[model samples]
Target: MKYVFDWEAFGGCLGMLVVLALIPIGAFVVYFIFNAILFILPAIVAGAIILAIPVGLFYAFKEMVFKKVE
Candidate 1:
């Protein structure tokens, strides 16, 4: 007995394969954007904290450490 190939089913499977290939690419782009945002968030928070520390140190020095002896 010989088997027959169904062109319509083959074409549908091909199309589905193409769609499946694209799914990972789309998901990768989305995942990269999300992780990039997550990574940048900590850097932004760290920068803010670092900036505040100097300002606070300067304010404390002026207020308490360096006093006018009059």
Candidate 2:
């Protein structure tokens, strides 16, 4: 019978554990910070466009009726 301890195998197993543990945490962080913003970006742009519409109409009305060139 022979007893042996393999440092390389132990280090590789530890590295794999760290990587596996980090993957889900990394995914969550990326989703919340980056991908989630990307997902909402279209809605944000749409809101800006919606907000601009009323201001545009107001400007158009002012030019048509209030801006009197006499």
Candidate 3:
């Protein structure tokens, strides 16, 4: 059976998806030489931290601040 529609929630999700799709546009606009270097260095550092950190704490905080244990 099909669930009844909620247009408001659908519209909100569509808006979020549109905003997310704009991220690559911003990335492309940042391809200028100096700006590219500026962005790339920090991204490398952040990636290193992701790889360096311990697995459990890394994934937990990366996803959310407080995760409950059952």
Candidate 4:
């Protein structure tokens, strides 16, 4: 009987381990990005709403004044 060390099998196993290790890391990154967007989304929407109110009022007044002028 002869003993043989299979380098190809070892390399394949090592590659699989690396890929498995990266899966959780990739999932965590995706989760963090999603959570950050969720956290910021309300603030972004509120800011837009707050700014829109003033801009809308300004445009309404401008149209009213311009209509009276013409």
* Cα lDDT, model 3, residue 48: 57
For candidate 2, the lDDT comes to: 0.54
Error of 4 at 53 (Å): 56
Tens-digit lDDT string for candidate 3 (1-70): 3345456655655575466455555554555535766677555555555464456344543334333344
lDDT of 2 at 56: 55
Residue 62 Cα positional deviation in candidate 4, in Å, after optimal superposition: 79
The lDDT values for all models are: 0.54, 0.54, 0.52, 0.53
Clashing pairs in 2: none
Indicate whether candidate 1 or candidate 4 has the larger TM-score.
Answer: 1
lDDT of model 2 at position 20? 49
Model 2 misplaced regions, further than 4 Å: 34-70
RMSD of each: 31.7, 30.3, 9.8, 29.2
Task: Tell me how many clashing residue pairs each candidate has.
Answer: 0, 0, 0, 0
Query: Which sections of candidate 4 miss by over 4 Å?
Result: 1-3, 36-70
Residue runs of model 3 more than 4 Å from their true location after superposition: 33-70
- Tens digits of per-residue lDDT, candidate 4, 1-70, equal 4345456655655575465456545555655777765645555555565566557546643443333321
Better of 2 and 4 by lDDT: 2
Candidate number that wins on lDDT, 1 or 3: 1
